[model samples]
Target: MAKLYTQESPKQKNLQPKKESIDFILNYSKALSVINCKDKKFELLLN
Candidate 1:
C-alpha cells in the first residue's frame, strides 16, 4: 500500500492550478463583486 501511495502522489502534484488560471479566477471574482454592487445600487434606486 505504501508503494501504491507513492506512485499516486505525482498525479496529485499535477493537479495544482496554473498561474494563468489562478489570475483569471481572481480577476473574475473581483469583476463579479463590482457587478453585484452595481446591481444592488440599481435596485435601491428603483425602490
Candidate 2:
C-alpha cells in the first residue's frame, strides 16, 4: 500500500497605510475646495 501527500501554500498578508497618508488625503481635499472656489469667482468676474 502507498500513502499520498499534498502540498500547501502560505496565506498572503494585507498591509495598513500610515497616518501621514491619511493626513495627506485630508489636506489635498481642502486644497481642491479652495481651487474650486477660485474658479467659480473667476467665472463670475468674466460674466
Candidate 3:
C-alpha cells in the first residue's frame, strides 16, 4: 500500500488530499479543459 503524504518533503506534502479528493480534482481539471476549449471556439465565432 502507498504511504500517506505527511512524511514526504515539505514541498510535496503541500498536497495531502485523500485518494477520492484527488480523483475529484483530476475530473474537474479535465472538465475545465473541455470548457475552456469550447469558450475559445465561441470567441473565434464572435470574432
- Among these predictions, the greatest TM-score belongs to 1
- The sequence of per-residue lDDT tens digits that candidate 3 reaches over residues 1-47 is 99786765557647666999989777766555322564473222211
Better by lDDT, candidate 2 or 1: 2
Instruction: Look at candidate 2 and tell me the lDDT of residue 1.
Output: 60
How would the candidate models be sorted by TM-score, starting from the highest? 1, 2, 3
Clash count for candidate 3 is 0
Please provide TM-scores, in order, for all candidate models, with all chains considered together: 0.39, 0.38, 0.34
Model 1 scores what on Cα lDDT? 0.56
Off by over 4 Å in 2: 1-14, 34-47
Q: Which residue pairs show collisions in model 2?
A: none
Q: Which has the higher TM-score value, candidate number 1 or candidate number 3?
A: 1
Q: Write the per-residue lDDT of candidate 2 for residues 1-47, one digit (tens) a residue.
A: 68757666656677668889998887776555322564473222211
The global Cα lDDT (0 to 1) of model 3 is 0.58
Q: Please provide, for model 1 over 9-28, each residue's C-alpha lDDT reduced to its tens digit, 9 standing for 90 to 100.
A: 44554577889999988876
lDDT of each: 0.56, 0.59, 0.58
